[model samples]
Target: MCSSSSSRTIPAALAIFLALLLHWSSAQLSPSFYDMTCPGLSDIVLDVVLQAQISDPRMPASLIRLHFHDCFVDGCDASVLLDNSDTIVSEKDAVPNAKSARGFDVIDAIKSAVEEACLGVVSCADILALAAEAALGRRDSTTANMSGANNLPGPVDTLAVLQSKFAAVGLDDTDLVTLSGKEP
Candidate 1:
């Protein structure tokens, strides 16, 4: 009887530990994360995005899609922005992203502007997150995952497939509907 009670207590303690770890990890992201480091970060990103929108009406949607793709695969690390390198194959070359993923130039412009404002202080991953007005304080990943990119849901994916893909990423039916509502 004592052994059974101890086993249950052990599992409960482990579960609590795991829950706190996940919370702590996610709590690293804060909206004002770059406020002190990059004072005008959002303004800079917004200026570039607005400029890009003038030239291409689809720029905003493209950026949102880019952010979504990056997050879905690997938690918004900006691996999608990587180009072919000696050690990296780049998610840009993935089937879902090859032809459809775009607005790289705009990202480049934002990076340039941010660099000019605060050289080597801001990260590309953070820039991508800010441009999309999503989360913040994410660090860039050193490596890209082409297979993960390849598995991302495509435009032609069925409702069931989309739901499955979103579920795989810990998103629910409401998330599916909300994200699906965004148009490109």
Candidate 2:
């Protein structure tokens, strides 16, 4: 049997461990990550996004959503961009993504421009992050997590359910509201 003090200490220790883990994971992201390998990466991404936004005002938001979905399923690995294949089921076909997610064409254009500028130097996952205006060092995932994509929070989910889902991803109420673009 554990005493009250020990029980409290256990939770505190667990919280600290989780915080450290999150920090360690995000510490790899840097604004200058592609400075050497892909000097023109950001400019290429920005140009494509700007052109896309001109044609579709919602392109910016859609790119951000695409980044969020990709990250949520498998740590921003660009798995959301995959299509149905013999070895992969694809997150795009998930209910939460189908008919809602967009900006793939923009991403493809960005890839083309980036490749022309600096071939094989950038990863699609990093490109998605850049399109969302986030600078991060990310790698592409060869496999997609269909089950994880299916479990993403939906439009009609209750507040409690949303909270639970966000919490599972180490996000809180503030993150939930901010990401949802809603006011508390």
Candidate 3:
């Protein structure tokens, strides 16, 4: 009983759905990603985060914010950590990140320590994710500037605005609520 146009539409819809599903599947993150290569990675990160907190009590909060910002802008990649160069525009200079983001030095120190212990093993991206866990197990994006900063909602933003920002990064209402409760 199906018309020809309806039949063609169904196939096209299925193709698009499959394409999207594949893309999402490929983007998954796994805790076991570093199990074999760097068993001590989490401990290393937690130690560093704790040490940094000693000097700067804000370190933990800043790290949590930094990780969230990085994820929103670029799927949790450490692209946010890259400094500007002749061939690259750093995400740090981006509007949302400009003077707002901190804890890079802490991340650098952590990276150095991790590298010393397990060289060529862990990635800054994964470190960022794991760092969040260590801080929370203890605690706790991009370069588009206008678009990037705009993507991170401000403190005075309404619930709707906050929801929009979270949604922009593929997070849902529940995620937004969860994030809002993570502050000190």
Candidate 4:
């Protein structure tokens, strides 16, 4: 029921193309992506995220989780950034995100800065991607997940369940182990 109603199935070829597009958008993103269009883009976004992290120590992890949730729901197209409207039911209101998702204000602040610098050139998707990357360097606390955290693996979950979760996203065992190794 949490799945987006707006999501539609496509032909195999179209699905492949969309997958490639998402991969290309992520793989091609670089710190220098805005060098020509907005020379200060990276600095601006980094500063804002840093400030946000200082104000709310959980901001970094929230930013990372927010990006992951956004990507999971809508292929990292920044659909999560959309506020609820008459015709739009925002992903932010999803059960996984109801109170867990954060850093929207930071994203908005960064978006404003990007707009002032490069205007229409920067996409919200790019902002989210950049902010998630910037958030990596910031410190985060090792906080416990609250009840009903449906989207993440449980601490005592078996290896099979963990592997299955990764497989659902097209990740192999290698990716699962590699990602698991990053956990504290």
Highest-scoring model, TM-score:
2
Which has the better TM-score: candidate 1, or candidate 3?
1
lDDT of model 3, residue 122: 79
Model 2, position 98, has a per-residue lDDT of: 92
For candidate 2, write residues 1-184 as lDDT tens digits: 3457755754554444334334325778887999999887888888898888778766776787787788777577899998899999989999999989999999999999999999898999889888876657888999999999997989888888888887887777876675554444
Please give the lDDT score for candidate 4. Answer: 0.61
Model 1 TM-score, 2 decimals: 0.79
Query: How far is 96's C-alpha from truth in model 4 (Å)?
Result: 1.2
Which pairs in model 1 have colliding backbones? 71-76
Report the C-alpha lDDT of model 3 over 1-184, residue by residue, as the tens digit: 3357755754554443333323333433456667777888888999998898788766766776676676566555677787777665777877678888999999999999999999977778767756655211111123323356446756677888888776776766755554553221
Model 3's alpha-carbon lDDT is 0.65
34-53 per-residue lDDT for model 1 (tens digits): 89988999999999998887
Ranking by lDDT: 2, 1, 3, 4
TM-score of 4: 0.65
Worst 10 residues of 4 by lDDT: 135-144
Off by over 4 Å in 1: 1-25, 181-184
RMSD values for the candidates in order, in angstroms, are 14.4, 12.1, 15.3, 13.2
